[model samples]
Target: MSVIIDFFDETNEVKEEQIEMIQGLINLTAQMEEVDEAEMSITFVTNERIQELNHQYRGKDQPTDVISFAMEDMGEGEVEIIGEESARLLGDIVISIPRTKEQAEEYGHSFARELGFLSVHGFLHLLGYDHMTEEDEKVMFKKQKEILHAYGLER
Candidate 1:
């Protein structure tokens, strides 16, 4: 169960503890879901950068709190098959730092809690969780809350 994680961003103000927590979230999400040799990338960006990404990737043209682009097929919690001899790429998680700050204040939660929730939510999507339907939202939201709670990030 090896996971390769890369964090890319130009900001220098992010706390070491926050970085550690986000890395821990990746490991915990992969471990609890039993993924094999997963790889993920996380990028923290400002509103402008995230807005460009949202417009290009999702065609929304707005900055959201977080976005995830999952590459692997999660196979309903069964054996997630990566091609033989090929490393599994889970996906990329892009977070808007400014938006996160605003949402944290708006929702009346700690910045850490909001960030952790977004990280976990994005990780779950990499694990094939979707919030499109009611049932799917229930499962995804429940898993997100559970993981955040397990890490003491729950509101």
Candidate 2:
């Protein structure tokens, strides 16, 4: 599995270690979810851009820290096979850098930690994991915690 991360926006404050943390989150997801072959893109956008996306996609005019567009949700027995030349487009994850920074500060965690959390949450959404109901929230939250713990990011 490969996470085709594409950083955007003018968040030049982002450090190399943070980028590596993002990659580490991807590896943790692949290992925990048993995703053999998958490809996803992660893009960082400004608050204005993310607000537009939220309005267009979710009908929400406010800017969110992150949003996800999932591709496929295979069942347990479903087979995942991809050609060597073909990279399945799993989905796209768009995050608001300014929002994330604010959240990180508010949550008393590192910016990298917040970024990892958003990325993992977006990836899980792509896999059809949602926290709509109590049971669903329990499951999804547990999985999120596990993935974050794997990266040593606990709040």
- Candidate number achieving the greatest TM-score relative to the actual structure: 1
Residue pairs clashing in model 2 are none
- Where is model 2 poorest over a 10-residue stretch in terms of lDDT? 2-11
Give the per-residue lDDT of model 2 (tens digit) for 1-155: 56565655455666677778887898789778877667777788889988999999899999999999876766579887666766556788888889989999999997888889998998889878999999999999899999999778987
Error of 1 at 44 (Å): 0.3
Lowest summed lDDT window (length 10), candidate 1 = 73-82
Prediction 1 TM-score vs. true = 0.88
Per lDDT, the best of the predicted structures is: 1
- List model 1 lDDT by residue over 1-155, tens digit each: 66788888755556889989998877777777887787889898999998998999789988898999997755466685646776678889988888888999999998888888898888888788999999999999988877777777767
> TM-score, each model?
0.88, 0.84
